[model samples]
Target: MPVDRKSLFKRVPSGIPGFDDLIEGGFPENTTVLVAGGTGTGKTTFAAQFIYRGAELYDDPGVFVTLEERAKDIRREVKSFGWDFKKYEDEGKIVIIDGVSSSVGLPSEEKFALEDKFNVDNFLRYVYRVVKSINAKRLVIDSIPSLAFRLAEERQIREVLLKLNTILLEMGVTTVLTTEAPAPQEGRISRYGIEEYIARGVVLLDLQERNIELKRYLLIRKMRETKHSMRKYPFEITSDGIVVYPSGEIY
Candidate 1:
C-alpha cells in the first residue's frame, strides 16, 4: 500500500476567511506548521478557528491539545464566535486534550528544576492515544513554547520538537503548533530559534501600529512543497473568527 504523491500534496483548508487564497488552496496535508506570534496576536484563536472550521465545514475530525488554557475555557472562548466545541466533542468530531492539567505537578516557579520533571516521551504517548481514539486528521497544539519552557536546555527543546514533528508525520495529521515570538525581532520566528526549521511550514501573526491604530498582519514565512504568497497581509479578528485581507496593503 504505497501512498500516492497526489495524496501527499493534498491541501487542507484552514477555513479562516481570506486565508486560503494566499497559500494556493491551503496547507499541504499531513504537514506540520508552526504559527508564531507575540502575546495578544491571536495565535490561539487562529489555531482554534482552523480546528473548528475543519470539523464544522470540511468534515475532518480534529484534536486540539491545550497546553495553557483549560479545555472548558477554550470551548467557552470559541462560543463567542458561534463555534460549539462542546457539541463537536459530543459528536466525536473534535477532541481537546488538556496538557496543562497533565503537567500541573511539574515545577513552574523554579526554572532550574523544570527539566527533571518534564517527560517528553510520556507527553507524546498521551497525545498519541488521544489522536488515535478520535481518528483525527487535523491537530493543533495551542502553544509549543510553553511546552519547551519546561525543558532545561536548548538542545532538549530542539530534540523534543524534532521528535514531535516525526510523531505527527507518522500519524498523518495536518498539525498547527503555536509558539511565542520575540517582539518584532530580527530573524526570530519563535522563542526557540529552531522551531521554524523543525516544522514544514511557518506562518507568522503580528501586530503593528499604523496611524495610532493597531493593525494585525499574517505572513507566510515558509511553506515547503508549495508555492505561496510572500506578502504581509492585513487581518482582523471578528465575531466570525480571523479574516485575512490578502489583497489589502499592509501599510
Candidate 2:
C-alpha cells in the first residue's frame, strides 16, 4: 500500500518571528526537535518564543520544562517581548516546570559524587503528570544537557533520553528540546551529540564573526520526513523575539 506521507504528519507553526518560513510552515507535529547551540546563542529564548507564539497565535497550549533557569526568571526575561507568561499560567494556557528548583543543592560539576542522589525516572514522571494536567499541545525542555548533567553515567543519560522520547511521542505532543553545543571553533552541533540522534529534527543556532561584527545565523541541519532549507539564514534577537532574515546576508 502506498503510504500517505502527508497524512502521517501535521505542521505545527513555531510562531517565532521569520522562522516558520524555513521549515515549510512549521515543525512536524508530535515530533521531538533538538535546538542545539553554544552558550549565548539564544537557545532558551528561541524555545520560549516558540511556546509563547504557539499559545498566543495558534491557540495551542504549551508546557515549558526549565532545566536550568527558574520559571519566574523565564517569565521575567520574556516580559520585554510583551509575553506575560504568568498571565498565561493564570489562565491555564501555559505551565513552566521548575527543573532547577527541584534539583537544587546538587553539585554543578559534570561529575557526580557517589553519595549524590538523582532520579531521572521521578523527574520524567513529574513532567508527564504536568503535561497531562495541562493538556498541552507543545512542550519545551530547556537544555537537555543540564538535566543529563545530574546523572553520573553516560548510559543513564541515554536511557533517560530514550524513555523521554518515547513518552513524548506517545503523548502526541510536539516538543522542542535545547542542548548546549560545543564551542563555535569546534563547529559541533551539540556537546554530547546524542540528542541529534534521538530527535526527529535538529535546528542549529550559531554566532559568527562577519565583517568585524558578530552575526547570528540559523540553520535547519536535519529534519526527518521533511525537506528544509540548507542555506544559513541571518537572524537577530529583538525586543519582540528572535527574527530570522531569510533574504538577508550575514556579512
Go through the candidates in order and give each one's C-alpha lDDT. Answer: 0.84, 0.83
**All-Cα superposition RMSD per candidate:** 5.3, 4.9
Quickly count the clashes in candidate 1. 0
Tens digit per residue, CA lDDT, model 2, 58-91: 9888989887886767888999988898878888
Please, what is the TM-score per model? 0.89, 0.89
Per model, how many backbone clashes are there?
Answer: 0, 0
Clashing pairs for model 1 are none
> Model 1, range 1-251, lDDT digits (tens) per residue?
87554455789999998998887678999999999998989999999999999999999999998878867778789899999988888899898876664467643332112123557897787788778888999999988877876567656888898899899999999999999987664667788888888888999999989999999999899999877878899999999999998889877
